[model samples]
Target chain A: MTSDATPALDPAVADRLKRDGNGLVAAIIQQHDTREVLMLGWMDDEALRRTLTEGRVTFWSRSRGEYWRKGDTSGNVQHVKGVALDCDGDALLVQVDQVGAACHTGSRTCFDGRDLPIVTDQSVTTDGDPAALEGDARG
Target chain B: MTSDATPALDPAVADRLKRDGNGLVAAIIQQHDTREVLMLGWMDDEALRRTLTEGRVTFWSRSRGEYWRKGDTSGNVQHVKGVALDCDGDALLVQVDQVGAACHTGSRTCFDGRDLPIVTDQSVTTDGDPAALEGDARG
Candidate 1:
């Protein structure tokens, strides 16, 4: 649906995209200065075009099945700082200057305080020593 | 397909996941100290479990239809630093101490030097002034 008949995305840029089965690419938002990941969203060509040229972030809401511009309702604006496509072209990192909360739940970031327990390398000393390797195998 | 008889992921963490149609969640890898995004991968419950307890990053390769552990073949290991789930429980941020290149193309990051042009807020002065707003509308 051509919402406003704005110009399409740059063909050179579009040629690089490797959309998923749903013709969607993952768009990751990060705070420009802090480098903190703010949230993850999906974007199609149209949504990406808007995000790239409108000076704000927009996403194709999978659940809502429609396009939604960030900060339109909640005032949590994401002023675009930069946009980069992954080498595989399946993901985009959109750096922004966030005005307020970046999560739907009003948190500073979607990942804030949501850490999961993970085994770090320091926790397991498998220095290739036969005994340590055997111990790791047993554990 | 339980490859080994290792314990499953923590019940609490497992319950928080919101997998996609492919029974996978997007995992964004970031360099622990630099906070630079390295790459994005997909992980199913099994892959997630392995990553949580294996002290390394693992992903479900959609193209290969199998699980692959990072650095296993490339020798560019991703030593787990931390893992966090988004508020929506549909995405993950995995912080790691990367040993070498994080992309299959042998780049430091999948997104390195792939920036795309984006219009910044400063480019368009929409100060809510009627005249500026009108000008923006025209432009």
Candidate 2:
């Protein structure tokens, strides 16, 4: 169902989306100019429509059960440049001109190198897999 | 729970994840060296396990109700570099060394600038509210 606050979405584009049981699809947000990925959010029909129509990113908050415009509170808005549907139609790639930090922790991207452990040759090979062996040997 | 075939996952890391009602998390795949985002997928515990253990990206196929190793048939394998959990823990950022095209249609990214229409100033204001008017004025 489209949000009452937004205009109707493109029927062809909307029809292609494969929403999950929760009527939500994963929206991968990317910075338009640099193509750096910022974050991933959930978008229902209403959220998608609002985002497409309003020219800013809107997401369906799973916890709050509401439509959240990205910059409404945090002022870290994602000004949308383009929205693309993947071949599977289950996910979306949203290209946006991001302002400020997209991450809640003040990191530029959610995948910033902090919490992520770098995959080393030792970790994969120690587990006793021949494939890991090949991986180690490749290095 | 970690999969039997893979190495034991850190309990702290696993505990942080907020799985959906269907017990799945959104996994964003990116090219490791170049940092280009490729696609998004869904993963359950087993899928995560297989990805780490097998050194390739594996996702839970919702429609087929099975596990799929990317590039197993397509030859577009994603050799993992690292996996990071978002601060919220509901989403994942998987860094990998992508091989060939990440998209089924041979695009480097699932969201390759094909379907996305560039957002120009004209589209938003024609059918918008005062907020959209403000957005237009901001530009």
Candidate 3:
């Protein structure tokens, strides 16, 4: 495993990254075909480099303080389909072709069945006009 | 503008969150209809509560050290369609009906055109069989 002192990623790519104080960026993994968000993980330059070149998703485990390649132990591999960096360069969007469950709980995706109930604004019109609210004071 | 000392989120939902040392979680925003990832933001309990209860998305600006509601200035509102917590509760997936550009750069998405060149493993079969690699030593 490469240390944070030495970045394995291309200098051009590494220079754009805005890592957190811990020298890590959040990686959001999504299913390429279904477009389902599979999971979220942390990655440093090396882990991002490995995922891009090695064709499999790799993440730096914050709790374990080590690097881990997805599906290495569980056989639920995430094959790289595409990778993109967000505008601010603080996050990554990793599109992959998932082989099996993407969650440790055996769910197809990490966000599956984990919805948090929220009050949807009924005032917003179907055309997505918030100003269309009927007599709403919050306007 | 609620302080971190007093959480505004539902107790049940707040209890599940595994926030970072700074008491923040990564929020991944996606377009509801297109399923396109719009952007990524940080949220503390108060921001999460405002996003859930209010019609629009609210995020805590790490740099500005304040709360901001999406579309307040840019008119690129993100009306909440759904919100979910990742399995580990360290991240959030916020589905919304985006009104305009989601990127500060005026792009449709924060990840728009920011693709990284990576070596895709052509050896992996179409059926997603990693073992189907022919004469590949990395198997």
**Per-residue C-alpha lDDT of model 1 across residues A1-139, encoded as one tens digit per residue:** 5576667887988999998888899998988778998999999999998987777888998888999977899998887767789988989998888998998888899987777765444454222332332222111
Q: List, residue by residue over A54-106, the lDDT tens digit for candidate 3.
A: 87888999899999988989999988776788888899998888888999999
Scanning candidate 1 chain B in windows of ten residues, the lowest lDDT window is: B130-139
At residue A50, candidate 1 shows an lDDT of: 90
Local error of candidate 1 at A126, Å? 23
Candidate 1 vs candidate 3: the DockQ winner is 3
Backbone clashes for every candidate come to: 0, 0, 0
lDDT score of residue B137 within candidate 1: 18
* Candidate 1 runs further than 4 Å off: A1-6, A119-139, B1-6, B119-139
CAPRI-style docking class of model 2 based on DockQ:
acceptable
Residue B22, model 3, lDDT = 92
DockQ, each predicted model: 0.37, 0.32, 0.39
DockQ of 2: 0.32
lDDT of candidate 3 over B64-128, digit per residue (tens): 99999888898888887777888888999988889989998999999877877665444423223
Model 2 lDDT on a 0 to 1 scale = 0.74
lDDT of 2 by residue, B61-80 (tens): 87788999789898888887
Query: lDDT by residue for model 2 over A1-139, one digit each (tens)?
Result: 7566636666766788888898999998988668777888999877887777667888999899988877787899998766777888888887788999998888898756434332344563332233443343212
For model 2, the stretches where C-alpha displacement exceeds 4 angstroms are A1-6, A113-121, A124-139, B1-8, B118-121, B124-139
True contacts kept of each: 0.63, 0.34, 0.64
Better of 1 and 3 by TM-score: 3
